[model samples]
Target: MSKSYKKHPYLKESSQHTKYGKKFANRKVRKSEETLQHKDYKKQYCSWEISEYKFYMSEQEVINEFFASRNEEYHWMKKFKTLKEALTWWKKTYLRK
Candidate 1:
């Protein structure tokens, strides 16, 4: 007597099934990794570059530029507690003048 084997329905061969299974397996592996740390490092590096550029400007230059472009309605300029703060605002807001 020959032994008869029962085949599982889920194991049926189909091109679409094989393609979907491969894609699902690849997606699972791709999602299981750290990405935030790299992104944070990139953001920090960008911020550092901006600060370095701002710091490169001389204090006198910042002050001169600030007063040259001071706006009467922008009262926030008075609230700046430090020269650096005022200078930063000035560079961003009024340096074009």
Candidate 2:
């Protein structure tokens, strides 16, 4: 008697990804991992990079960058009660100009 075997769905010899899956993965995967809208918001409001080589940036990243760039010029930003307040002041004082 011969043994009968079944193939596993996930253990295929070749990839099971379809054309649509490949396309979606290629189109969506990015080094920065940020959406277009988020990038725009960060660039315009947070003074983030608007170039093609931009990376993902959080609020903390913004604060750190702010301190690094301004140095002693805007040291008062550290006195803000919240990150939002400091960011708002930074935008108004520097980015808006």
Q: Considering every candidate listed, which one attains the maximal TM-score?
A: 2
Tens-digit per-residue lDDT, 1-97, candidate 2: 6533332211112234334444433444443456656445334232221122223334476688656655565564557756677777644433432
lDDT of each residue in 1-97, candidate 1, tens digit only? 6534332211223344346544554455456554545444343233222211112344476676556546554654456656788866645543422
The C-alpha RMSD of each candidate to the native structure, in angstroms, is 27.9, 22.8
| Candidate 1 regions with alpha-carbon error over 4 angstroms | 7-13, 16-18, 34-97
- Provide backbone clash counts, one per model: 0, 0
Name the weakest run of 10 consecutive residues (lDDT summed) in model 1. 46-55
Backbone clashes in model 2, listed as residue pairs: none
Clashing pairs in 1: none
The residue-level lDDT of candidate 1 at 12 comes to: 24
Global lDDT scores for all candidate models: 0.46, 0.46
Q: How does model 2 fare in lDDT?
A: 0.46
User: Which ranges of candidate 2 are over 4 A from the true structure?
Assistant: 1-62, 65-75
